[model samples]
Target: MDSTKCQDHEPSTKLLNPEGPTATIRPIDFTRSPLADDYSSFFAMTIDNLLTPDECARLQAAAGDNWQTLSKGNAFRECQNILVFSPEWASALYDRIVGHLPEEVKALRKGDRLAEIVVGPSHLKASVGARKTVWRIKEANDRLSFLRYQPGHHFKPHCDALYARPGKDERSFLTCQIYLNDAPLSADGKSDGGETRFWTSQVGKRQKPPAMECEPAEEKEAPFLDIKPKMGRALVFQQRMLWHSGQEVKRGEKFTVRLDLMFERHFEKLQPNS
Candidate 1:
């Protein structure tokens, strides 16, 4: 392997299974955020202020009127209720905001040549399993969901499920989220804890546990990353590679919009010359 090339020796299976060894969280500045770089081996990154305050407010109002309680098995029980946007609504939002992305972010979204070079051929080959390939962006924008959390609400630690459907050939490979509002402050002017927490360790098949129930005895002493909600900030990550949770909202309401980026797989079939 070339030292200049970005690569990870760990098997991709560990990313999907989540029973593997812990991986430390590495933070990167949004201005120099990795698009098609070696940093992708970790599969997660944050981009600050991806949305304008006006956009966040507009979406939040729409979600407020449409909120619905999320069911137990559908989402982790600890997650609060949510409002899902119609496909039309989501697509419009994607169109409006995608142009503001950095050149690398745009390339990654389109899966362009630079993205392929940075992420490596093996990563792409393993993901779609085609000898010859063409990558296209398939947005799950229509499936965008808005989540709200009040005091004590939280989403437990878990890895996202691999996107697979019995009849569909496409799959979701990435997760994206935009924070709509700052974590609300308490009476004393302290922020309520509505941070998204990422753990160094993965959650195995021992039955998914609630965030409160599964927390380490000395949370302050544990190795983890906590990202506080900030208005307009966005986060993107390889869905299957990270074990994460929404920490409890300690004082006031927290709001966010979630979207997934999918890829449609296509392979060329060889034809015999007549």
Candidate 2:
């Protein structure tokens, strides 16, 4: 038998859409948000209309094989890191491109068969990608997505980056989270739980630290954006600069997808010029 014929696996040659153009995340000019006060949390913001109900349903259906329970041992004691179980819908979405690429990337792309369930023509009109404000950090060192699962079973506290292994620029950039399911605990009419909390840190502590030891804060309040986990709603921010956490699931189970991006050293200038 020919070796090519005998082989069941083949290499993929799909050229990804060129890491679109450079995108800038800015603060609302009208309102004074803490997020606007400092550039540390600059890479972060929330986007609505990323997905629709139909698309969420499709993702839930696809998210089966990728589903895993969030273990307590792996849960973040100080920062918000926890393994989450993908919902049936999200599991379905995970299955769509298991081999094509990383599950998180597929989840973020808007044209997958599963994604079209809720993706409307206008969905991308004002989106981060469409606006070309978020230029994919194409450096070889750019950070990719990390698939995570958080059941209604867990919660994490306010802290900065952790769980990221060694790689240039990985820890130095921003973090964006896309909600896969509307958690019941999520209020504010956005979605449910699986909230992304933004916290306030104490003075004289401007360095990033490991996510274990409890760090005392001068004071803290509800997240600047207590995001509800709505499918396609992306929460963006600087992972290391923002003292944020995954709020506990109180009502129903939640499903979420996470991705972290590291920008070029000088691109931080594109950040809010605080």
TM-score of each: 0.64, 0.49
How many backbone clashes does every candidate have? 0, 31
lDDT of 1 by residue, 82-144 (tens): 545355555655543444444453324223454453333533563333234444455554566
Q: Candidate 2 — which residues are off by over 4 angstroms?
A: 1-31, 34-41, 72-136, 139-152, 160-172, 185-193, 202-225, 264-274
For residues 1-274, could you state the per-residue lDDT of candidate 2 as single tens digits? 0011111211111111112212223332212555544333133455554445555444434333333333443554312223323232223322322222323322222333322221222322234432221222321122222234344444454444433335542222334565766656435644444566555543345443423224434334532645556655656544333466566555666655554443321121223322
lDDT score, residue 266, model 1? 57
